[model samples]
Target: MTPFTIETNQYLTQETQGFYHTDFGGVNLPNNPNYLYKLKNDPHHNWSDDWIRQSQEQLYRVLLIDLPEVQNHIGKNPLTICVVPRAKADNTYNPNQLLFKAGVRNAIITLGNSFIDGTNYIQRHTNTKTTHLRQPIDGYNNDGSNPYVGITNATCNISNNVVGKDVLLIDDIYTRTVNIDEDAIQALISKGAKSVSFYAIGKTVFNH
Candidate 1:
């Protein structure tokens, strides 16, 4: 499938572009055969190991076939592969949550030096209310600051190594109102990244 752009505004210095492989999450709950949804919701430890492994293989396949074009679009410079931190504190992931991250690591190994593996480049230091469970009025923190900014400031820590590097940020899903991806792109740019591109495994398709 052809990739689609996720960045929709001029919020950054460069016109950053993001692409996703499939559609997920619509008014029709579960959305039949939503592979991305299945990949994310299925845990590596507590769930069916077979399903998770198969899902990860699918992810690796997509990345192997798709990422080359993404690299070409960004020019010949090797792009740093960065994974968006999960919603909770980094320490919470004792055995490493996020099977998606593991898939990314596998893909990077297969791709070799064509991509720089900075998957853990952005680390979360504190926990934030999971975005999906938020109330309508939960857009800001108790301090009245923009929640995205506050969340990034209080929880996120960018590596000094990202300074002056071109980054390709990865996430499992992209939904418009939940601007976590948008905030992350801004965070990377602000941290002296020469540029940043985004890629989501799936983009939420609103069925209203």
Candidate 2:
């Protein structure tokens, strides 16, 4: 599969780089029922749990094949993989809520020593507004004022193990508006990570 480079901005930092596997057209949009979208939202669409599992299994296969492409960009040795936490707090998630991270966990297990499994290296302890739900409130604007503003240190815990380590932060999808991936990048760096690179299974492509 071909990879796309994530564009950097003021908040994202030029020093850190990001990559993603495919383009996503979002849930309500037609012509793009991409794998990551389905895995993330099948339950809301009334699809069976089996469908969710199949989507996750499919992503597991892709991660095994495509993550190495992202690895090629990480100049550091022995990188640890950290996943961006979901909307709900970690302990509050059900099996459905756990799908994305589960896929990452499985991929790390198969990848062996090249990638360290630090999926839970950053843990969300507070619930945040789910971005896809499209609520009227803007999560990005009032960031410091509210815990639900987005993925920020106010709602998450970064592991001490990240100190002096090269981290590859992974997310199911990367959307510019919400900037969840960017926030995760900031959280990791603020925790003293030596370097941080990002990877998303899919990136939102509006015009596509």
Span of ten consecutive residues with least summed lDDT in model 1: 137-146
TM-score of 2: 0.82
Instruction: Please tell me which predicted candidate would have the highest lDDT against the true structure.
Output: 2
TM-score of each: 0.80, 0.82
For candidate 1, write residues 59-89 as lDDT tens digits. Answer: 8898898788788876846889999877777
Q: Which parts of model 1 are misplaced by more than 4 Å?
A: 1-14, 26-46, 133-147
Off by over 4 Å in 2: 1-10, 13-15, 27-33, 41-43, 135-151
Writing each residue's lDDT as its tens digit, candidate 2 over 21-40 gives: 77777656664436565565
Each prediction's RMSD over C-alphas, in Å, is 4.8, 4.4
State which candidate has the highest TM-score: 2
lDDT score for residue 40 of model 1: 53
